[model samples]
Target: MATRQKIALVTGANRGLGLEIARQLGKRQMTVLLGARNAAAGEAAAAGLVAEGIDASAILLDITDGASVSTAVQTVTEKFGYLDILVNNAGILPKLTEEGSPSQASPQLLLDYLQTNFLAQVSVTQVFLPLLKHSTAGRIVNMSSSIGSVTIASEPLHQNGPKPPRLPYAASKAALNMFTVLLAKELRPEGIKVNSADPGLTQTDAGGPNAPYTVEQGARPAVWLACLDDDGPTGCFFTHVDEHVVNNPW
Candidate 1:
């Protein structure tokens, strides 16, 4: 008998850091599922991975859409009996159209950010949890950012400089991090591991060329969290810096 290959689903994997994360997981021999809103782009990403000799495919998924997400869960359930890893990588970083800090940001704008970044992630996790439970060991990696750190937000100079104007984005990530901690605790009895990964400023489409590091470096933390073995740390937030795992304070 042959061992079954683990399966991993990375949301918003059509491009940028999401795509790189899927590629890296595919390289590990896991059947990587690239989830994207655009079917053509998703398929293209999966095709590129296949060209790299990886077992990969694309699934139509829109984290913000209830129907799309439900369909994706059903699709996974039918195509793969169980899911070993889930990388919630879909999110937005909206820039300030008007001038202001968090207090100045409109309620609607903040709500929009929370809907996609925090609520949708939690909803997706809940929907796919049954599939995750089917695996002997399950891992959940919520892509977060250091800017989400409440402690860091309080700093006069975050990351050694003024914080970006995206307050809603930061708040959403903070909520996601909270979900990681609580979900890990809830799933501990079932041996499911949940953790948050912050891929610091990196050179991705979102990070831009001016960013210091590469997408490869940014994906490192999430990949590490996804491939964690039994007895690995859970309910924690970490960032990969200098190729070392550094715990981030909540």
Candidate 2:
């Protein structure tokens, strides 16, 4: 017998890692909902995926916009009845100043980062929790980062390590990780699994040109978490290479 087709939604799927993730999931015969803030970009990306014979569609989603998020959720629920997976991949990183410090970061920029990177993610997940619960195996993947590890940040020995200084972004991701853990714990009784995914430093706009990993590499961890079995771990932070749960470097 053939496996049942799973339904998945990926935020910010118009380009980069989000788009790649959508493509990979589509190849697996999953129905993909490509969520993008830009309507044209979303449609174009969906078209490209459809050209590849994948069941892909675009939905307008601006994480910071509550109305947009609600409409997208309603549309998906109406069409599919339930969502099997949700990838909270939309995030933002403000430009650093000459000092390259968080203290100098503009208040508006910090607020924007928080709105898109943390608040919007949490809001969308809460709104979709009911639909996710309707799935036999609901999965929630929060795209986090190694920079969010508080253990690594405070470690003096690792200060000279690979980690760079991205205060606002890193702090937002840390907050996201906390949400993943708390939500996983709250929803575990319902057979739902929520986890944080660290795609590593991939060559995306966020990762910059000097990033060593490719979008494919960065997307692996999220994909792995999305396709987890019933017994898979939850509320943990995982890197792309290994399923190893990241701990405080300290």
- Per-residue lDDT tens digits for candidate 2, residues 42-101, read 999999999999999999999889999899999988888899999999887545442146
The prediction achieving the highest TM-score against the true structure is 1
lDDT string, candidate 1, 78-122, tens digits: 998899999999988665464257668788888998999999999
* Clash count, one per candidate: 0, 0
The per-prediction CA RMSD against the true structure, in angstroms, equals: 1.6, 2.5
Off by over 4 Å in 1: 96-99, 159-161
Q: What is the C-alpha lDDT of each candidate?
A: 0.91, 0.86
Structure candidate 2, residue pairs in collision: none
Task: Report the error of model 1 at residue 144, Å.
Answer: 0.6
The RMSD (Cα, Å) of candidate 1 is: 1.6
TM-score of each: 0.96, 0.91
